[model samples]
Target: MALFSFYNVRKPRQYNHTPIYWDPRKEALEERIRKNKRELGMEEPLEDYKPQIKGTFVEGTSHLKRSYNRGEDTRARKYKTFKFLLWLVVLGVIFWILFFK
Candidate 1:
């Protein structure tokens, strides 16, 4: 309402962006040329590419990691449940002593 417009709020400005065009065929052609040069000894081939495995610290250790995480979660959940039950018992005792005893 104009009558309730005590604070003036300005609209956010629009962003004008110009997108760049990518040619996949050109990229593949350049990649092939580089590979060919490396094979022909024109360009020394880069160090043997060993892809890093991000799933585990060591190869075939993902299962161990998963089990460790599962154990930690279960232990924490059990401790939390034990604490909650202990508090509930203490409160129940206090309530019984106050009202019935």
Candidate 2:
């Protein structure tokens, strides 16, 4: 009848506390980088900061040009006269349904 019953167990208290300090602004940037590496004897090289490959990689070089200009051949001759008046009203409704009904 005692398989596991600490049913809400409670026994652990020994804090011996000691931790509360706060002084870092990265120790004033490591004392201004150790006073600029003891007055510049040489530690500066870190500036490529990277980011620059935008646009145009040259495959099919397009700035835009299909080239028919006279105002795109007058709007492609008014869309080929509105597609030849919609194929003359669908061939006059199939020649009035093959010669008038």
Best by lDDT: 1
What lDDT tens digits, residue by residue, belong to model 2 across residues 10-95?
67998887758756897889988977885675654334223232322322344222323223455676797899999999999999
Candidate 1, superposed: residue stretches over 4 Å from native: 1-72
For all predicted structures, in order, the TM-scores are 0.30, 0.21
What shift in Å separates residue 100 of candidate 2 from its native position after superposition? 6.3
- Candidate 1, residues 1-101, lDDT tens digits: the string is 37556477677999998769888899999999999999998996676333544534643677556656666555776797899999999999999999998
lDDT score of residue 13 within candidate 2: 91
Candidate lDDT (C-alpha), each: 0.77, 0.64
**Which one wins on TM-score?**
1
Clashing pairs in 1: none
**Candidate 1 — worst ten consecutive residues by lDDT sum?**
48-57
Q: Name every residue pair that clashes in candidate 2.
A: none
Error of 1 at 45 (Å): 31
